[model samples]
Target: DLDEVINGALSVLALEARAKGLELRSEIDPKVCTGLCGDPGRLRQVLTNLLNNAVKFTEQGEVVLRILPQEETSSAVSLIDGISGSQAALRFEVKDTGIGLSEDARGRIFEAFNQADQSTTRRYGGTGLGLTISLQLVKMMHGKIGVESEPGKGSLFWFTARFEKHAAGKAALAKQKPLPLGRVLLADGNATDREILRAELTALGMRCTSAASGEEALQFLCGAIADEDPYALAMIDMQMPGMNGVELARTIKNDHLTKGTRV
Candidate 1:
């Protein structure tokens, strides 16, 4: 539901991006649970501002919006990080190959009615209220926004917001019709077992990738995490040649990157 809302928010400017010959795209992790408690309108406002800014500043290249569930130890550092047992942090990022910004502009980007320079407003045509409104919206969500840019290169604007995925959302997900679950990691030393599990998952509408050992599975998981599309589920044989199922599950649970996945 949240993802759908985000799509709607981005759609407001999609046509404009295309008209200017700019590519605008959004990606959400398959494992990101959709059921959440929050104001969709305010959430849209936050995303709208970021996307709006990304499109307005860029003359060429692409604008990408990425969403993923974040794992963190404290809400203080990133509110979208673990804020509570029943809640999870969802990170939103808007990256663009725009004109970029100066170090000084990055510092004051969130301030009300302030642009990187007076010339920015004259060239970009805005009152510089987008970031200011967005910052307040994020603050209301107990979240924070950040920016990284190098003049003439590109920029990455990111923020994190917490959401409570209630039991009802889980129930709804369980009731949803079968559909592809993005990527899955299959771990079993026995080639036969791995094939059988993979086939079953495939029939259930999933793309299963094989890992011969627990150590190998961890490597794949880590790589996938960096790519921001980690496995949604991991199937490991309880009895394997190396790094048995118990140990593998324990390792996955211990690591923040793969901890949220089903094992």
Candidate 2:
């Protein structure tokens, strides 16, 4: 169930990125598996916020989605790193090449409403509830969240959660229906989310792209149609710095550039 939920969260992010025309990549080790004694919906929500934040901030470059077997460490450090181990410890990481936070900001980044700076909040336009909510959920699920960033470079947000491998018979029997690869757009201020999403889309056999904001996503859509290759559908995030999802979708569906394109 947790794996399914994790796949769903990854799918959501991937679909969003494709809709925006951003490149996404993922490296989920097939050997790394886990089981969770947690609420799937809440877990998915927390994962969604972190992934969304990564995609929202990235203007260009790649985002990475990685799953490692490791335990949560501490908050005193600037970055979190770990090596492979015998006992299983599932870690979910979203790394992006976007506007990074200063050391001062990274300290309180997980706190509610606390971003890199006031200007970051204003320019990026997030409720700041994402990481806060994510932290709470991680703790509730017996996990930890950490952030590593360098100004003008990028950020890596990671969390560790417990998981156990599924048995072969049951694991083989359990399956999820394949998700269709439609035209999707992910609008965010982060690049990590975009890249991770892009990777997931490709894994699902869908074409994907990345955009930093709704404006960029619109521009991409317009350009796609201008190039005579439009999307079939779109999966957009409601929050963005410039134009919101509704406006962007309208611009694509109601305007000449993407009027023939699907939402």
Candidate 3:
């Protein structure tokens, strides 16, 4: 399954991301097909290589994997081989808040045995064949791969591939248990983390309110209680600037008014 492939790739690099205190997140579009007939091994390999590089280079912030369905236009349909009928055109992007590449470095990024610079090779210690192999594999899958980066900002690596939708698997997924409906409050200092969580929760049929800090979360919770519409859940980030998640949870638990709000 496509979902399994994505989870497997992320799981392999979870420890590395945690070691650097980086949050690894994935945002898959609900419209995207979960069961696809394609080379899952190659897809997993490409994702793992890109995610590994993102984690290795990023010292702080987060790494995100986003998958979305691409519009199937005439050009898109013509690009994929053996696309006899309707196929799912998917775009996969790996974004990171790591040290990015310069214009010159981005040009030669996919070359075999090459890295951004000599310092990158010495510091990161890789043969630099990951991107090269990823490019080859993507090409074999009749996909296109590339990257976008700035010297100090970060990088976004993206690729597009086409896959035949598996009707049996799609039907099975459609019959899965429906997501619970409720209002959820999300507390996270990082804007990206908050947005990612919010989007995922909203897609699952939940009303979401995002707070940038613990203090802000409390205000929302208190207001919701006063309005006689307390949130059903509160998802707090453990690491924040002030108050933190634990402190906020403790305060919520102690306050009788907001105590009913699950955290």
Q: Pick the candidate with the highest lDDT.
A: 3
Once superposed on the true structure, which residue ranges of model 1 sit more than 4 Å away at CA? 72-82, 172-263
Clashes of each: 1, 32, 0
Ranking by TM-score: 3, 1, 2
lDDT tens digits, residue span 132-237, model 2: 8888888875577888899989899888765334465235434533368666666666665666576667656677777888888877887777787777666676
For each candidate in the order shown, give its overall lDDT on alpha carbons: 0.81, 0.70, 0.87
Q: List candidate 3 stretches off by more than 4 Å.
A: 72-86, 176-181, 226-228
The total of clashing pairs for model 3 equals 0
lDDT value, residue 100 of candidate 2: 85
User: Against the hidden reference, what TM-scores do the models get?
Assistant: 0.64, 0.55, 0.86
Ranking by lDDT: 3, 1, 2
The Cα error of candidate 2 at residue 153, in Å, is 1.2
Worst 10 residues of 2 by lDDT: 76-85
User: lDDT score, residue 212, model 1?
Assistant: 93
